[model samples]
Target chain A: MKRNPWRDIRLHGTVLVLVVIAELIGTIKIPITQDVAITIMPLIYTIILGLAFYLIKPIKWIHRKQARIAEGAMMLFIGVLIAKLAVSSGQSIGLIFEMGPALILQELGHLATILVLPIALLLGFKKEAIGMTNSIGREPNVAVVVDKYGFNSPESRGVFAIFIIGTVIGTIFISFLVTFSLSFLPLHPYAFAMASGVGSASMNAAAIGPTLAAFPGLETQIEAFAGFSNLLSFCVGIYIVIFVALPLTEKIYNWLEPKIGRESIMPKKEDEEDA
Target chain B: MPDLIDGSENVSVHGIMNWIFLLAIFSIITVIGNYLGYHHPMESSIVGMAILSLITLAGVWLERYLPFNISSILYISVIGIILAFPGMPTSEFVLHYVSQIELLSIVTVFLAYVGIGMGKSWDEFKALGWRAVVITVLVIAATYYGAAIVAHIVLVLTGVPAA
Candidate 1:
């Protein structure tokens, strides 16, 4: 999802309609279980965008095409292998057999999974990686307003790093604060909300996956709650990010521009090696 | 995968009937199982993944025929769905998972055409152009500590011992 850069008119329009339909389902409160059926449109959007090119266009035996099919299979393999190993190792250590080697082995699978998730993600999103990634750092096109803002300026890049680090620190600080407050106040259980809140749902869940398994108790419950809550919140968060967050961010940028100075927002010249 | 695509060998494996057949079977079984209330037979995504993988292995090992691909689709789709929607319980995510799998599958095909424009910074966030990072951080912090303190505050107010 991160790498997609294409803005195909048909694809975008189709996905947009599907998302609208999905949102409408949520609004209607369908008994088909909004949680499950709500996924229909997003999935449909994704599949249509994906399979549409091949199914409708020149590629008839699309699935048989080596180039694309290979990548799909490769990704499927990586995701499955990581998930499979992580689960089997964890199960055997916790449920079936109790041995240090077995336990370590299982833990390794979990660790590897956490470490490689982002990379796997990058690979899977091969189509949009460029556009999406650029959309993040700089204006995708000159026509956009963020254009006047220097994407190549030093301050812009440096400030970006500082803010990201700050967010990470903030996420942890927030989690710790919650723990502290729990000792003194009555609070609603976060469930899976907090973990996803820390970052993306997949990320927090993967990172804490091992901890939750190894320590199964109230601690685990809290993580599960955080994971679950985060997952739900993530869906809402993405929309807010696109609509509310991005616009609000621009407003804040404009407000700060006079005081912060134009130079304050300039992104620094990055090394070619890094690129 | 770049190699696979760029490779000169053109030995093609037509999976049209295979794809249709497998998709049919997966939809049938998932729908029937879901309707029958075998919802979430596996407790966790991890466990469910393992179970499905095992079934996939069985199908793959059983024959070189179409069932392997069908099983593969179902297994991968299940994992993809869980990864995409972390909040969804396995029982509640049957159809949801299948759709994500197909979506991810399609996107994965074009991954090679893309590249990352990495920017150098003192940290991971360096080169990211945004002031709203502050709001992002602040909101996250507020939510985290806010929940924690309130939970504790309630306990103290109620005079319930902290477990």
Candidate 2:
């Protein structure tokens, strides 16, 4: 029956105000070529605002809590805006339907562990190292790993390591990759957008932003597909990691580790346990 | 004497007021966004906010009633689909104005919040050291290119136009 403090209106109101200013700043554009131009871009400024709140003493002291509070407040809008996009996407239902296979296939990208784990093993990474970098590092991935492997397992360190990397730089990395790939690839933007939503909000933003820049007309469909696909990723991602991705990685590791020779930078788990 | 106001759990003045406050802010910001970004009529932005606010509220209440929790995004998304159904009344208007909503600009707010959230974890990151960095880079590249390759193949096979 107790009220939640995070729901305080003053805190949410402050975030909304700051976000409006940031949005205005991000919306401003400058022409670069006959057809192309550059702009402030929202994600860039948002990160700056976040960094400022995080690093600056006064701002961190005064606004850090509000910034955190604002994060939750803004989540409400994400659904609303995505819904608005879905409404606009009705015209493209046929296209979305046709692209269903592509959307699901694209989501496989989030199962990074399946592909990366074997390679990490082949490259002389310790057996424990493979599990850490294999899956798309997100909130739930940690839970699944801890549950399956136990918190003290050598692999847990890998999960924690990648989890931090995923948290700190994942969004920016995904955004840049999306933008860069678009420059050369013949892939559809919707496919990329759906791929971006692989259960991480910032990564979704990074993926959607560049595609939005490239193909403005398809914005609604792209947003809708990405949003829906993200929801799917969130709902099913844990199971995928626990069952499909993890099992597949283990099989690959079992096959490759013997061939690669198990020399590794990390101390051997068996040796550590023995000591 | 009959009770002037019924004491029911469903009736919440505070909830209504909160939604109104949010709706007002959303409408004002949407107007500014339209001016700076989409250039839609001011009236459309206001109307769009009102409609969206209502949809959000409905989604919230719907979630409360559902046997299992459904995400608000999906709930509102279903509402959006029904509203935008072909030949439905106001479907055209909903289509026109929803397009004018600056979703990307709004997304910036979420990303900023995420950054702030990440910043709060500076110590944990510092402690993880460089191994995490290498792993992160590889994981990101692996996921992105892996997905991109699949997408590219699908697009090529479906003939949906390649980059």
Per-model chain B TM-scores are: 0.26, 0.63
Tell how far residue B152 is off in model 2, in angstroms. 5.8
Q: Candidate 2: where are CA atoms >4 Å away?
A: A1-17, A20-24, A27-40, A60-68, A98-275, B1-16, B37-40, B112-122, B125-136, B151-163
Q: Model 1: per-residue lDDT, tens digit, B1-163?
A: 4444332233221234432333232233223222222233323422343344443343333334554433332333334335433334542343333322222222221111110111112233332323334433433444344333443344345564323
Model 2 lDDT per residue over A62-170, tens place: 2434444443344444445556555655544545465568776666766754656655665556655655765876645654564356434556556756765675677
The CA lDDT of each predicted structure is 0.30, 0.59
lDDT for residue A72 in candidate 2, whole number 0-100: 37
Reference-based TM-score, model 2: 0.55
Clash numbers, per candidate: 46, 6
* Model 2 chain B lDDT-worst window of ten: B1-10
Worst-scoring 10-residue span by lDDT in model 2 chain A: A266-275
Candidate 1 docking: what grade? Answer: incorrect
Model 2 residue B46 lDDT? 69
